[model samples]
Target: MPLVHIDLIEGRNDSQIKGLVEDVTNAIVKNTGAPAEHVHIVLNEMKKDRYSVSGKLKSEEDQ
Candidate 1:
């Protein structure tokens, strides 16, 4: 089994998230020989105010 965890600031639509997971699953399957059904993905979407980099919150960065 292959497990993948992805974290991002919340903004993308459902289709975008679906595409991201599909792409990630394909990559894992291709590289590790894992079955697509056996690949597990966890997506953690954080609010812009809850995520930060270099002392700047994502929401602040956007302003």
Candidate 2:
């Protein structure tokens, strides 16, 4: 079994997130020979204000 964790901002639509999971699962299956049923993908969405970069919150203009 292979587990993949993806974290990003919390604004993606359902279709986009579904496609992302499909693509990432495909990649894992292709590269590691993992079975589709054995591949697990977890997506974590965070609010912009909860994320930070360069000592500034992601909601800030600098992000």
Candidate 3:
């Protein structure tokens, strides 16, 4: 089985997230010849406060 893990800030709607997982799974299947059913995808959505850049928290921005 092939496992793909993705982490992103929490904001995207359900459809966008679903598309991401599907796209990744399709790419893995096409390139690695892995079965769709055997592919494992994990999507981790973190709160803005849990992420940061340049020593500043993401939630501090005008998101």
Candidate 4:
């Protein structure tokens, strides 16, 4: 069994997210020779306040 974890800022619509997941799964299947059914993909979305950069939260960066 193969697992994939992806983290991103929370905002994409369902269509976009679905496409992302599908593409990731396909890539995994193609590169690792893992069956589509056996490949696992996980997506984790966080709010701007939960993500930080350069010692500042994403929400604070725009200020």
| lDDT of candidates 1 onward, in order | 0.93, 0.93, 0.93, 0.92
| Model 3: per-residue Cα lDDT over 1-63, one tens digit each | 998888999999989998998899999999999899999998889999999999999999966
lDDT of 1: 0.93
Error of 2 at 63 (Å): 11
lDDT of model 2 at residue 14? 96
Record all residue pairs in model 1 with backbone atoms less than 3 Å apart, i.e. clashing: none
Per-residue C-alpha lDDT of model 2 across residues 1-63, encoded as one tens digit per residue: 999999999989999999999999999999999899999999999999999889988889644
Clash number by candidate, in order: 0, 0, 0, 0
Q: What TM-score fits each model?
A: 0.94, 0.91, 0.94, 0.89
Tens digit of per-residue lDDT, candidate 1, span 1-63 = 888999988999999999999999999999999999999999999999998889988899778
How well is each residue in 26-61 modelled by candidate 4, as lDDT tens digits? 998999998999988888999999999888899986
Model 2 lDDT, full chain set:
0.93
Candidate 3: misplaced stretches above 4 Å?
none
Model 4 vs. true fold: TM: 0.89
Candidate 4 structure lDDT = 0.92
Q: Which stretches of candidate 1 lie over 4 Å from their true place?
A: none
TM-score, candidate 3, is 0.94
For model 2, name the residue pairs that clash. none
